[model samples]
Target: MALRVLLVHQSFPSQLIAVLEALERRDDVELAGIGMNPYARRGLRYRQYSPVPVAQTGDIVIDDLASKATLAAAAAAAARALSYDGFVPDVIVAHPGWGEALYLKDLFPRAKLVCYCEYYYLRSGGEVNFDPEFPPAPPEVLHRMRARNAITLASLEDADVCVAPTPWQKSTFPAMLHPKIEVFHEGVEVPPADNRATDRTASGGPSVSFVARHLEPHRGFHTFMRAVPRLLRADPSIQVSVIGSDRGGYGAPPSDGRTWKSVLLEELNGSIDETRVRFLGSVDRRRYLDALRHSDVHVYLTYPFVLSWSALETMGASKAMVVSDTAPVRDYFTDECAAVIDFFDSRALATRILSLLRNAKIRTSLGGHAREAFHDYELTRDHGRAAWERLVTSF
Candidate 1:
């Protein structure tokens, strides 16, 4: 018998890509999806399912009264639309953080719900890592934030199973919910490393690359720019290639008023030569992978992040990384296996980079270990397939 499965998520391509790929391997499974079009760019919709329509509403509003009402109403409306279409999935897999799962239990009473639980807030300091630059909110504001998260918790009660990617994430939920949670890493294809040697003199000099969506304040881009001056001072042969564009614009603009990139450029103007830093705005996938292949070191600094796809990609490509010593990362790889550092300590980060650049043996060893770790934890396609198979079988 063919199993009918429906996956729901706001960010479809990102979280669902691995699961979709895994499901594709099965001959007897039917997979469909419902997701929001956050960006305006249109492409081929989900392979099997019709796309679910969504309004551009403020689902993340901080205010208590407005936030609760907005989420409740949206959930009710979404449930009604899906139910009216006569799309009753045997098994439903959803990412519940966006409040989409609020009324899912009521709508699909017979279906078993499986949730992708990303994070649960705790009283600890790491919860504020998303907005690290700002000081901690007042007690009342914190209470309100906790109250907001209650809706997320309520949604979980409807879930028959909950998938969490990291141990830290699994630990965040209450003890009662632990039995229902399963640790599942989103696996990716481990591409063979492009070991093709390049002439250092040809591309100006030995270059390191940072690839991400933007060089924003939150991503520690400015800190990296600051470290560039010191790094260049020590070794003039080293160059930095930043491969990404600003939020709303492409290419370099002349003296824009106080953008994060502009500020960094100004700060490092005199200390580091302009030629040493190259900001190649966003490039295609081939170019991005090529940059990773050619890079000597990849620096990934985040305040407190769950596993970043970019970081994992770099690891899969066998690039040595210097990542922040956050809970999510530490839960995955130890210091001996991968380079880890304090998030706020720029000096420590710079020192790690310098060490990796200087020691080829260390770099090679770390890269090898990173690749092994990736294969063990990240590239296990069969495991993901098995998880999906189990979900379908239960259905």
Candidate 2:
């Protein structure tokens, strides 16, 4: 009999898409999914579930917990129906961050449960209060943050195995559960060099680039924006491309209902020339990779939390970088591969960006090292393939 597998997530397979595709290529495996985005991957039977409404609402903290509980109950009902219909999976994999996987084991007692353990909340020593500019989060907000992780903690009780994308992320979980968790990144395909060409700079000057899912404080957009004027002061001929949506993803939303982008732009008014800066709002994969190829210097800054895939892709593409020296980056980035800087220091950031652009020899040398580092840690590379395969079999 084929190996029957089921994948679950609140939305699309945020980090599981590659795993889904890999499993689909095997004739010995059968695949299915339960999520909000059924079309994210092909060759899988999918069932969609929506959040059950909470009738009573009071404190934001209480309401949030009730909502997650409702989602878990609703999803459990759906899974029970699937079992009744004769789709009994041998193994179940889920990203249980949103509480949807809370009762899966109860519904399928025989199936081994493997969870994608993304991040565990901490009062300090994590992303919570990393930025000093934002006043300490209120007591109620902190309570809600811990409450949010209740489902993740609960789901771990029965998980046969758990996967974390990075070592730093895995460390955030309680020490007792460390034995059950393994570190594995969802790999990226490196496009052939000849397939894409670098974009030509208008003035023949070096170009710097930044890419993120959203221009939010958690990823250090404010720090990047603050460094721009000083960067232009040092190298007026250089151009910059900022790629991402103007919305908050990890951090709190903007107070005035304006995007972090808009607030930063307003603060930068009349100081730096807008002509030198181009805001390429959230491009597709092809364009994003092209941006990495064309960039002379790439800047990535983030808090002490889950690392972004773009950072790894930039390294894979062999782009010179000035990266923030934070916990998430310390695992894969170092002085040898890129210029490491403090997340809060705008002056130091500008100085490093200027230096990299001015020296082509150093840029190429560091970029070569960056690409080498990618192959060293990247799952898509040959060296990591066997380990990734072993991980799947273990699950």
Candidate 3:
């Protein structure tokens, strides 16, 4: 009989998709999942759950606690419904950031629980106070941040193994949990046809590229935008493409009621050459890859937080990258492999990108080295699959 497996994530398999794909090819394992939607992954059996309605009157702390409690309850109920169908997993893997995994252990006591620890909230040396431009989060907000870690802590205490996607992310957890947590990159997808022949710079003058899930301050959209005017002024022929949705992903939304994109545009005023700069907002995967494949140089910046999938995608596509020297990013790339720069220094960013664009030989060498490093250092699906199988089968 095949081993039954259950995967859970509040949103979906953002980090586990590669592992799920690998599992799909296996004849010895059966897969199922519980998420906000059942349609996230095809073929796998899935259960959908939604937060139960709650009474409105409460403080931020109370409301936050209630919301998470509701999600945990819903997930637990879904697992029970799955159990009613006589489906009991041998192993359970979940990303516990959103409290979805808090109650899974209760539903499947015999199943080995593995929790994906994406991030741990910190009052200092983290995203909360990393940017001086934004007002420091208040004491109450900081307290709430600590309180928010309750679900993660609970999950860690319950898990058979804790997997963190990066070393820096793992470091954020309490020292007691370090022994239980291990580092993983969630792996990058390198398609079979991924080759330098796809470079479109043949017809265009250095297509400078930037990509992220959303265009927000946390991911350094403002910083990248600030550098664009100088970059455009330095090389009028180069065209820049900024990809992703104009929305906030982390921290609080802009207090001024304007998005980070609007704020940066207002700061740039008429300085940016609009015709040369393109905001290709949230294109499909194929289009995004085409943009990266054609990119002469890719720029990625972020505060001290979770690494963006876009960064890995760019590196996998073998594009010369000018990345921010943030804590999370340091684990994947170094100065030798990528043009690592301080996130705040727009001038340095512009200069580095300009140099990369002008020197094709250097671009090819840097990009080649970066791609090789990713493959050699266990950042692909092959390595991820091996590590995941080891952990899943250990119990």
Clash totals for all candidate models: 0, 0, 0
Best by lDDT: 3
Residue-wise lDDT of candidate 1 within 302-360, one digit each (tens)? Answer: 54545566777778777778887777777656676678887666787778888888877
Best by TM-score: 3
lDDT of 2 at 22: 66
Writing each residue's lDDT as its tens digit, candidate 2 over 214-249 gives 999898898999999987787767888899988658
lDDT of 2 at 245: 89
Task: Report model 1's TM-score to 2 decimal places.
Answer: 0.82
Which 10 residues in a row give candidate 2 its minimum summed lDDT?
Answer: 191-200
What C-alpha root-mean-square deviation, in Å, does candidate 3 show against the real structure? 1.9
TM-score of 2: 0.94
